[model samples]
Target chain A: MDRLLVVRCPDLLDEDEDGTALRSFVEVVDAVEAYCPWITAVRPGLCSLPARGPARYFGGEDALIRSIVGATSDITPVEVGVADGLFAAVLAARRGLVVPPGGTPDFLAPLPVGILGNPGLAELLARLGIRTLGDFAALPASHVLGRFGADGVTCHRVAGGRSGELAELRQPLARRRVDEQRGGGRPGGAPRRATVVDEPGFWGGVGDTDVRAGRSLAAVQDLLGPDGVVTARLQGGRGPAQRARFVTWNAREPQEDSTLGAPWPGQIPPPAPVVVHPTPLRAELVDARGEPVRVSGRCLLATAPGRLSVEEAPWAEVTAWAGPWPSDERWWSRSRRKSARMQAVAGAEAYLLLVERGRWWVEATYG
Target chain B: MFVASPDRRDVDAPPPGPSPRRSLDRERDLASLAVLAERTRPVSSSQTRLLPVVPPLADLLPDGGLRRGSTVVVTGLAGGGPEGSGGGISVALALLAAASGTGSWCALVGLPGLGAVAAHDLGIDLARSAVVPRPGAAWAEVTAVLIEGVDLVMLCPPFPPRPAMARRLVARARERRSVLVVVPGRAGWPEHPDLHLGVSDMRWDGAGTGEGYLSGRRMTVTATGRRSAARPRHRHLWLPSATGAVAEDATGTGTAG
Candidate 1:
């Protein structure tokens, strides 16, 4: 989970037919972008940006939040808060609290389960006398899977502060509305035509191939919306997912590898995994006795793993294995994570498994 | 196939009748004209028809490169789970590496969170590559749209295509002179491609029980195809060497990790 700073505007949460609220939200985004260039328009009234970089530049997270609130308040009442993930950060913004870096679990512990937004799960939990997120988080993950299912397991992870995202929290149409507002009043509901390929090379002359590709890609954006087509830009980070960022593809701006060569300590040696999952898949690694294998406090494997099963699929024999390489990221902050990565090979396939808080996840695959 | 070199500068250029230029200047003009002709020639020429592939993979292709306007299916073991492909995706990415590095545009459809670092290390030029990670129900349409302009379009269809849908895409690629590389993970392709590369015997090296890091993988790829590539051919390769680039593994002994 990223340390995200969310900006929530109460006045502009809903949109009117005249598009007044959306336009105002776009202005709010522009204002926030001036402080941090990479802010995401998560929804009509909600937006977020990674707080770590800007906090460093602006002296501290407190100052960063204060400045943003001060700036955006000129347009509308804005709430600013920083926490470990989008879900928590949004909650923090609503309450105007800056939860400490590693303190999300504590901050979220006392909250009602209703905040998770799954009415069915929340209702079911209430019936079982699990009224708060703390109670929900205390349930053993394996038990949650059998009784409540996958989505319940995800909510449990979120409640426990092991994960920070919930798919239900987002409005899918919000991003396109923001893009439409920024692109200057393109009608909200119209599907853009393929022939409306107006993006040309802003630098120098465009090639014939570029133009043709642009037209087709623009057509795809029309079909899948602007965020469908994307181009990856490599950046410096330890984890494979962190090493590259995917930005929605735009024909007007050509992609560049400007952030390619920065040093990252404790980075794993290549060959990198061919497929890095956006959201890691749950995995099970157990020893010969059928007991779960875990990384000890001393960072050594508690036992030899015998079989590996990913996403509840059929188990396969673990032919070869390596490391419990301790990746203690953000060690200086409250949000610091002490997870370990290991490579496990199952006949014909290899997987990069991550263990954090006694749970295993298949982070990437060498396909 | 008819060659379509449409240069007419020779006919349009001024005749050598009215004014006489210095011999050196005339020679320079002709040299520049030749360069221009080379630059403007259609890419569909007989010799330039094939897109370059890494040397190790070239021997498997009948044309020693990806022949333009051809469909190639890279297949891995069946029942290879959603995440498992028995190294089929690696082979497909390797095929794009050489072509993309040479400035050809490539688009990947239905591949989410592309390990771009892996692609970059494999010598792929990411700036020219476009990824449509999740095309959902519109995958065929998305692949078809991209095939119109992209030099190579790799499709990992989210679902098995009907024979007609498969034929249309294959025909579209043929007509557009685009290379279609399909990694039919489980949802199989209905049509036989121009070349079919099957991956088997996959093994990772340089790792033991809590010992070394994953340095590389050795796999056997068997290429069988139509016409010129009728005979099946198999080659052993380090699909991703220590540095994440493909290399020929001359030593047939694929040591297990």
Candidate 2:
């Protein structure tokens, strides 16, 4: 069994709200770590330090005890008890007793069963004429299990000071902290250096931390809306400035990059139109004679009209006309919505014109 | 003179008296020294550290750029502008471009539907930027955390926070030395901004229906606040000039902003 030293004060452990006991516990542990670096776990009133390596390093168990007593002497009035395991050490510390190696079970049996702090079990044990740990242990193990179930068995082991397993070790923030005073030049105690996460291309690592954080962020976004999140989806459509549109991030049916495979047409000050109406507005495309005008498949106006009014603009003469660029999506489907998108400029203002199903729509106004 | 020369000690002693010429010369030296001191007086270096704006746009800022730890209110037309959509929002993003490039994270709160393209085109690094579309009731909490962690936080406050809450946020931003750019909505600002930047008279380029492509936009940007004189400052800007970058209209009229 692994030998442990538990340092605690019984009276302070039960005091609630005021964290005076916890502070003293940490102070005692920090002081002990200076002399013996093999400190493991700490609690509000109890701390367990494995003593085999430190005992050998400091010459003997007696010398190690002297050193620990000297280190935390000025802090809290502490009881340091050494035993084979943590549960027994804590019990021994309560009584200020030290058990010789392999003598933990024998030393523990005579102690009161009430020390385990399980009220219901302690009350039942008292009723069963088992006031002491020895009486509890003397009872058949299978009988205790049958009566009190799993909790009774655990209490029985702890009362016997025969806990066979070591508690799991905790190492949170173990790398980020260093005690310069106690471990000035210790190689293992050096400050943490930059890791792969600091590198620009460190995203290649499996289960990347950034990606994990992004997943949580996306989850938050999902809680807010059905749309995954608004992302910039730049398009290679005729309108260069309006090429970027707010699209909901969909896991399925993602929009293809409009310009990814094909060579981008222009460089700076893109030639495509700047403003795109994400949701095209329905409007009337009239002719010069103030009548609803229609343009045929070849983009030829049937009896050219003189007026252009989309989104209720003052019927302005089309001072400039760009293109009837064909904008067709899902042509094969019966519900295919196809239209010819045209750019019209009237005195420093540009409008996106769409003719679909014999109806007109103003896609966007550059103004 | 001959009698004084006869006794060398007496001549030397008697000559040791104040003369008008020497006194006048001493007074002249003192006056010249006073003038020299006045000419080299100490200059005030009270100008605070600032977040960088592009060189052309810097002139439009009161302190030549966004002031650190100071909240600047940027007001733009609510919905009516020749320039398509939130003009003030665009200005706010454009101002943060330099700051983001300096490797500071910028969080945009209360702004939804601001796609990545326009921000990218305006030179903001979206990799280091965060956009919180709806910060409803947790706006103050989110703003506080963002300001504490990041160097710059842009909040579009939909309504005025409680005065005490607003003061606390301002205090935290000051303590943390982070720049807070608040785009006050119709409710107005809870606390007075150190600097106020407003945009008006925005005109779009590109003419006659489809005759010419929408090339660029020009807006008149006005800046005024407590630190500046009561007189408002003005400047004309081609927000996204022909080259697709913010530049000042050199021909446009303006005093220093």
Candidate 3:
């Protein structure tokens, strides 16, 4: 008997966040190995490594499968199937076989047409009302080849338990979960399994809320592919709605754009809605005065660094400089400051400033 | 000077022939002759020189390349001879074509009558070029502006300039690296130019009895001031010949005629 262990992962997409789901699957494989000390050999995925050695080491087909299934139950919920060939083993596993041996053909006979890799073949078979693998196997190979080409002949062979190929298993380095014991063991010296406890205590120091707007800026950067631009408007405070605008350039894609209020400890600002667009050559930024501010950086820095500014705070580094013109205030209001403004192009946006008291101060930045 | 005839009887009869009108007419003729002499005074070779159309011809000139931006004083004779020829339009076109082809923008100031369209007909694309017209004697201002940013400037002074002013403008042109082609009307230009071209005997291309439809009259081009190792060669160019004109033994040296 060939004891074939088929492990199926129910959720693949959830693994993208981190390797949690894959780690869970690895734990189950470790348990099986622990129980069956005489299990001969173990393989990871069936499609990757040669199965000949394991098949021969277990002595015969029937005994190998029984030993594998018996050990597997100690670990996780897995269906064990055994067969003479690779296709038979896989089909038997999918049919929910607990202990299948020499029943490979019967196991595969009534399986759906979808099991074959080719959808066109499955559709054609379904249209002909050939609901079982037996019906496909019954067709003459030459006639099927004449109608559907060489793939049809291969499918016909697979439908029967006569596929000459063995399962190719890809073996990964044996990973023992923290809770599982390692194989090839001397019992007394076994390492203690480390369990990852997902408790609130695990996340103790790391705050739950992101108080600074850096998180939002990071999101926006991701959405804009490399060489993108962003223009933003920031408005806050209780008094007559102060507004600031800024433009940033050369942003990377899949970014998140958000805004947060001043970074006060223990207070997290809600992330503003992110707006994304294809990359632009330049962007603009503004402040409550609707003027642009300049941003400067060291040229040696290859990537764009994120920027955040406080309302009414002055920025000293000037990247670009413009003006010495006096604004006419009598045309508008006597209270307005008739000063010279400088425009600065900064990372992710532009900053504006008004020169006063022999010092430069930020007026606006592109949002 | 009196031409006394051997027959003295006629002397006494003519001695009585002193009509006031004739004397007056003679005085008027002498005054007119003095005026004509002043108008047609031949400028000394040292006073001004005509440069050649191209720089390579500068070596062929006594002075290098029309004094490098000095005014070229062209003098036209009342009739006949090299000075009598009128090819200012052709000369202007050729100079412009050569300068602009070498990536220099030329400005023609003050001569609005110098049709850019005619320049186009002569193979100069003036559209990509500029022409500014100023009234009165603003050649100095125009010349200053041309030398500032432009590569070549053709300034037609409202009134004939003094010899010193012309020399100064030429010097300025050199400093500015501009080619200043001053029309002959300006006075007191430099004599030594890179190239001096004298044109004469211009005739219509197709006229008179000709053996073929395209046959044209021949013209004479003389190179008198060329200083290059190559001896200045003059040629008679048939305007409508299949090969146009031949010069310097079959080399076609003076085709611009």
Best by TM-score: 1
Cα lDDT of model 1 by residue, A1-367, tens digit? 6899999999999988899988889889889987887777777899889899999999999999888988888799999888998889999999998999999999999999998999999999999999999999999764775566445666887898866766566564677667766675456544422221223332212244565566567656756778999998888889888888899887647466654566788788999998998888899999999999989877899999999889998888898998989887632236756788999998668998898877888889888
Those runs of model 2 whose alpha carbons end farther than 4 Å from true positions after fitting are: A1-196, A199-262, A265-324, A329-335, A342-355, A358-367, B1-48, B77-86, B136-141, B157-172, B184-191, B254-257
For residue B96, what is the lDDT in candidate 1? 86
How many Å off is the CA of B85 in candidate 2? 4.1
Model 3, TM vs. native? 0.27
User: For model 2, how does the per-residue alpha-carbon lDDT over A64-96 read when each residue is reduced to its tens digit?
Assistant: 878887888788677888889777777677777
DockQ of each: 0.27, 0.07, 0.00
Ranking by TM-score: 1, 2, 3
Query: Which stretch of 10 consecutive residues in model 1 chain A shows the poorest summed lDDT?
Result: A195-204
Candidate 3, residues A213-263, lDDT tens digits: the string is: 112222222222211223323333311112222334221121123353554
Give per-residue CA lDDT, model 2, range B59-95, as digits (tens). Answer: 7676677777888778775442232333566677778
True contacts kept of each: 0.72, 0.13, 0.00
The ten-residue window of minimal lDDT in model 3 chain B covers: B76-85
What is the TM-score of each predicted model, taking all chains together? 0.60, 0.49, 0.27
Q: What is the fnat score of candidate 2?
A: 0.13
Runs in model 1 lying further than 4 Å from the true structure: A1-206, A330-337, B1-48, B253-257
Winner on lDDT (1 vs 2): 1
